[model samples]
Target: MKKIIYTMILAAGVFSTTACVDELDQTPHTEITSGDVYTSAANYKSVLAKVYASYVIAGQEKGGGNKDIATTSGYDYMRCYFNMQECGTDEMASTWLEGDKVKDISYLTWDASDPWVSDTYYLIYQTIDYANEFLRNATDDNISKFSDSDRALIKQYRAEARFLRALSYYHAMDLYRNIPFVTEKDEVGSFTPPRYTSSQIFDYIESELKDIDGDLLDRSEAEYGRATKGAAWTLLAKMYLNAEIYTGKARYSDCITYCNKVIGDGYSLEGDYSKLFNADNQKRTNEIIFPLSVDATHTVSWGATTYIVCGEVDGNSSENPLTYGVKSAWSMFRLRGELTSLFASGDKRAMFYTKGQSQYLDTGIDTQTNGYLMTKYRNLLDNDSVASNTASYGASIDFPMFRLADVYLMYAESVVRGGDGGSIGTALGYINKLRERAYGSTDGDVKTTDLTKNFILDERARELYMEGTRRTDLIRYGKFTTSDYLWQWKGGVKDGKAVNSKYNYYPIPQTELTANPNLHNDNY
Candidate 1:
């Protein structure tokens, strides 16, 4: 699947957007028209390939200048998502101020004009538009033209496309509460997309997942990196877990219902947590439900796992890039001083490289040596410490977007939040599985009485740091903009003060408002 992404010829032209020009800048792949590209059934698969490939590659060439969604310098889809999700929380700190919204994201000072935020907005919409184009082309009449086996397969492909679009909408709803929502039903040329309330977006996402259930392949049967029953179940479970926040309705019971589906199926914890982030992540397919598949030979975007691997490296140890299986050391982002205490005694998950770095960001994010560095992610093969070719290209490491570990955490959290049909004992057993893997023993296990919402939150920080869940977790727990929780440099202040409640909902990009008359700031 990783090599197939490069083997297929990228579609020359994709569906163009009709939304206000300021909100969308979707450049065509070539002079070729969407009609010419989707005429043949073989091209149907290729267009679908474009949908999945959009997550890993920025443009035609590997990290080349001919780009798709241009915004910031290193504006990879997940890379900017990481900035929005982690940098302002206690889990991560960034020193990068060069890009559009690098500083704003790290300090929680982002506004409508912030370039990176705007780019990220366009990128998410671009992804949805790609999926929409695929769905529109791969229709029932189109499927009828194919062989029986091909017809069955094409149906599955449509389900995967819907799931991907729903995933993007979930991200949009998470980052920016109220947003413009569109689907394949909405044609390419648009005057103004009706602004969707947070609940409207949530209902659309939930129904989309449920509608595609029969068409999705079973998790065990689906190929790696493609959406399957487990992926859909996991995503639905996640939205349900956050139902109160998204829709003002408690859906913990539904969260548990779907979580049981994933649990009853086959996913489990990988024996080693380190292998989950390493280059040979494909081997951990039993645990990782969906990933943005990447390798050094192809999909060389600096925005995904490459940024994750290189960004963690301290430039002072420039000689150690190969040690982490990449050629360059960004050393731009690091663990917050507050995170140092999360790793208690004997937690093997602690992979800090503090020899020449400070445990705390004493002088703040500017100085490279101000904060401790991490060895959590390595771009080399799991078995081989020394990998070749990775030094010249970017990282070969794949980022696990959703995995069994997250499912386990979600189940435990739902149970704690008054979700029914899941026993506290079962939740304990699931969490202990992660603890045993992290500590290599049962010594770190906790009793049923020890399982609380606070424990679940900290456990998530300890386990899911840098995987892009921190900011959302903080918001869900009522600690993001309130005085309830404070970390270093939050709200652009070194001491970490409570920001305005408006930070809860990031302002709509001013560009979006000016271009689309239907858009308003009343929600923000």
Candidate 2:
């Protein structure tokens, strides 16, 4: 599969050389067009491959030359999204001080000009534009040059492109609430699409997913790092789980409906919780429904798991960098005290290093030893091996975006939230499966009477920490901005403080508002 992704890299270079243009310009560059590139079935698949590559590759060419979005840095999509989603919450924090506006995220003092906020906005739309460009060019009339089997393959490509577009729109709807909506139907010259309310975007995403559900490959057939019926079901379950937050309407029954679809799809929990984050997680496809594939050799980048694995190390630790499959340590990201406390004495999920670090953070001296180090995500393989080509800037570990365990947690939460058509017993069974895995036995299993909304929140933290989900989970639980749930160093204080509720949704980037008059920052 790495060979295939490398082929797509060459394809991406050809596609971008011909049809790429500045996203903010709103007009296609007259230099070259899609007609010059979409000449055959292989070319059409290449173009579709570039749409998926947009999430993994940060630029036109690999290793930081021609970036998709130009911000303070190259601003890779996953790295920026992880910073925005995890840094400001109880799960993680950074120690780097030079040019680090990430502290603003931890402090809840961000405005529209924050580079991460703007980069996330740009990255989502950039990926959407790529998908739309593919959809517009890969029409049935345009693809008549191919055979019937080739045409059928192109149909699946079109559905995958639509699914990718909906995924980006789902992120936009989650983060920015009201966003400027565009699609393949929209003209590409000097146009500014009007803003759609959160509910409208929600409805659009749901309809788009349903329209493409049957066209997508099943879980068993989906290639590595590609969308499938399970991916669509998991995403729909997530959106429906947060329906109350997005549309002011409770839809937990709908959440349970999609969750059950995924749960019944033959996906089961991985026996060893830690093996799912190792370098060879590609083999753990039984549990991981969707993943962002990374490689030390072929798919090398400063983003992806390279950023995650190196960021959590200490500068002076006795641990071997080669053990984690990196050349050097970054000594940056660490856990807050609130996170380590969520685990019990013998929970196997409590994979934290507390040798020289304090559980309680001292904000006055925010050093590497201020908080416990999280060892959840490592660069070793399942057999305790590192990649042969491991370097300081790349890792082979793949990041799981959606897995079956998360679906189990979502199902339990929906049932506890008063969603109908779901049994509490089934929800309890789902949760105890995760617990049994974490504890390596049934000793940590919870009784049916122990199920509650609060218990699910803490259980999610214990199960899914450092996987780029804590901030959104906290927001959904109504504990993100309020002082009701405070963590060490939150809002830049030793004892956490409440921040303005406007931080709930990041402000629409001021550059976007200045560029398009049709868009406004109504929520903030």
lDDT per residue for candidate 2 within 1-524, as digits (tens), equals: 34233345233323331112244332232444566777777777777777776766677555544665555367567887788888889888688744566767778888888878887888878778878878887888888888998888888888989998998898888888898898877777556678899999999999999999888999787677778999999999999998988899989999999999998899988889999998888888889998887875556677777888877777676656665667777886888888888899779999887887888677532577877887877888777866634453477888899999999999999999999879999999999999999988889999988999899999999989988778789889999999889877677788888888878888778887887777888645
In model 2, the runs with Cα more than 4 Å from the true position are 1-6, 9-32, 388-393
Model 1's number of clashes is 1
lDDT per model vs. reference: 0.80, 0.79
RMSD of 2: 2.7
lDDT of 1 by residue, 1-524 (tens): 25333344565555666557544565666688777776555666677777787777767677634777554444667776777788778888776755424787777777787776777777788788889878877889756767887878788888988999999999999888888877777766754688998899999999999999999989777777788888999999999988888899999989999989988888778898899988888889889988888876767777688888888887675347777887778777878878877888889888888877787777876667777788899987867664435445667788889998898999999999999999899999999999999899999999999899999999998898889898888889999998898887888777888987767766667877888777776534
Give model 1's TM-score versus the native structure.
0.95
